[model samples]
Target: MTGPRLSTRLRFGAAALLVAVGAAASVAAAPDLPARMVTTWDAAGEPTGTLSKTAGMWLVPGLAAGLLGLFALLPRIDPLRENVAAFRVHYDRFVVVLTAFLVALHLSVLAVNLGYAVDVTTLAVAGGAALFYYLGTLLPHVEPNWFVGIRTPWTLSDDAVWDRTHALGGRLFKLSALIAVVGLFVGEYAVYFLVGPALATAAVTAAYSYVLYARRGDDGSDPDAAGRTAK
Candidate 1:
């Protein structure tokens, strides 16, 4: 409860529980799938290539397991492990939300396939929007780390650069999320709303970091050097 205090054990436990739930859902949905099926839409509600019934049932749960495994391994492998600890709570919550997103996607797919009268496209779009919004919320809190946030050469090379880049990135990501939400009403063009803003943010942040780094020089000068000298 206090600043995302769940231990690794707890996080793994949570992931396992979700895996079980997903497995159960797959079982429940199995009867409905054609012996040989083709997936038309991914969980994000976007059109995709086809897959067999077996692949469809196992997809989300398998992905959930793999992602959880990756999350567990990231901290140990990161160069800035302490920095990750500085915002471990945020990271943990992000993982939880991601896992939930996957679970929700699995359910949505199952419901749609089973003729439950649910809209797969709408569910996918809404889920993606939620993830984008939450990711935006977490961006500013993330410290400089190898496996997360706006990783760039400049941001990784200097703390000052990291801070400024993340500040800009935070705003842009939040704005992107908002655009994605609005995109829902735009019909087929909604993917652009989700993707375009993200591309712009990535490009802008990378360039901004480069510019800031260059201005600071190789030794990392203070941006307020002139003002400090004047005083």
Candidate 2:
């Protein structure tokens, strides 16, 4: 387990532990903590709405644990189990990054609840950029698993489709992350930078994969299938 599984377990375990510890600390600080805590921040850097302390403390850890468990089980349940094994390293790293992001988010909320001076928007933009960048890095190495990457039927059925689609997707995702970072400097409209790019990437990649698949015809004689699509 030292090579891959050990690291995987450690990544997931650490994330859950970190968040759980934070939650426990929060409760310790105020055992009678209100059912809801105001965690939201506005452009003026003020709290907006009250979030359930009980919810904020445990929500992310629970979600992280559930998702990690699913990631661990995918290989055993997927019909393309061998294909997943081909890029297990990339897959594992993706899971680790995701867990880290969740922890970051949980901490941000915890800090706000603890009355720390925090720029919630800045934290969100930075965290989003990092997560998107990692997603871009992961897209190309994905091997059509049921749980990750572009999972259109075309990508799943044809390695060529999957390769080409993810290649394009990786670029778009990286570009989206850059746009999100730039948006951090913008005013109230900064959210568009994050939302717009993500939507465009999803739409374009799904359409591109479908087109490529269709181009392959019923017999799968597309140029990509013949290994002529350039590496």
Candidate 3:
């Protein structure tokens, strides 16, 4: 692929437009909720309350867009350009979906503030949205760039490590999507619905690294062996 023919100026301008549009939409869509401390019961029969009210919903998209616009204007300076071509589609999808999830999450917070009882359907949709967005981060082209993907020390050290971790991450994210989808039917266990998948994903990724390391030998002498083992 020759890559898109977009010049730096055009790309920057387009990105700015997107940011403006997204910011406007997010502000318009978000409703003002009360400042009261909202409480919700978790799966363990404990009530949890913290400040869910956020101005970030209105601000983060624009901030992200601004950063992206800056990157477009000077992609040569953008660190993510290294492996971007490899994961272009995945990266693009990830950004779009992630933005959507953020928007949805902010909207849901607004709904809760307006006294809309967070029900099973709402929980499921929210979870699903988040999971899908996260899944995009697992694409091989995505890698351990600054803003996306799993950015652990191990993953950042070697391209092989990053690739393996992301592959594992993709599967975990897909599983999380399934778990979240099923959670929709289980009702108020939504906290568990969310927590379970996250924990599972973390556990799997950690285990994957450990297993890969062990198979690679203590001296770190066998790159081929390590890759094969991870695979």
Candidate 4:
């Protein structure tokens, strides 16, 4: 089922909330801290950073919320609204889960940067956990649009393409999640682990679309065909 449409006023309100949160976070804590800080690790599991106490505490979550709010505006935009429902479920769930994860990550950063005696490695583990959870949420939908899911020319052209791409995407994202989770244990290689799966998925999806199109042939069945055949 389609979700309720958000009005312009509501959208503006959401944007305002994000701004307020960010502004509040900027000023919330220690008044004498710097606007930006660096992160450092000492021998005793403490995070030393150039961040001011107030700024460090608010930076991550506030930024995360703001970015998410920006993303939320996409569906309401002109071009995106055209196919908003194509992968609505996946898209919505992804946003929520991802935003929540970002919030957690930011909080972890805050704890460490604020000299709260949190382990840096523990933050890494938390990030990995969130990544895994996000993968689980993304793997089960079938739709094609500019954002979320797999977007290939073929997938955009045909519903069949959309379905097949998402099916493949689901598996790839799951695999990616697995690799990323494993990397948490491996240490340092986690960046490679996190990125490799997605790169592989994009390559596979692109190849799959070419093969599908070649196999399907050039009939009116091609969703890209804009005109109808004459009787």
- Which predicted model would earn the best TM-score? 1
Query: What lDDT would each prediction earn against the true structure?
Result: 0.79, 0.78, 0.57, 0.59
Q: Which stretches of candidate 4 lie over 4 Å from their true place?
A: 1-28, 31-36, 39-62, 78-83, 86-89, 117-129, 132-136, 220-231
Query: Of the pair 1 and 3, which is ahead by TM-score?
Result: 1
Tell me the tens digit of each residue's lDDT in model 1 across 1-231: 552455756766776788889889889878877665445665455557657789988988999989988997898899889999887877877888889888887877766666666666666666777887788788888898999988888888888788878888888888888888898887765767877888898999999989888889555775756776799
Candidate 4: give the clashing pairs: 37-50, 37-51, 38-50
Error (Å) of candidate 4 at residue 116 is 3.4
Higher-scoring candidate on lDDT, 2 or 3:
2
How far residue 107's Cα lies from its native spot in candidate 2, in Å, is 1.4
Give the count of colliding residue pairs in each prediction. Answer: 0, 1, 1, 3
Cα RMSDs of all predictions? 3.3, 2.8, 5.5, 6.8
Off by over 4 Å in 2: 28-35, 39-48, 224-231
Kindly state the number of residue pairs that clash in model 3. Answer: 1
- Runs in model 1 deviating more than 4 A are 1-8, 42-48, 224-231
Greater-TM-score candidate between 1 and 2: 1
Compared with the true structure, the alpha-carbon lDDT of candidate 3 equals 0.57
Ranking of predictions according to lDDT: 1, 2, 4, 3
lDDT for predicted candidate 4 compared with the true structure? 0.59
Cα RMSD (Å) between model 2 and the true structure?
2.8
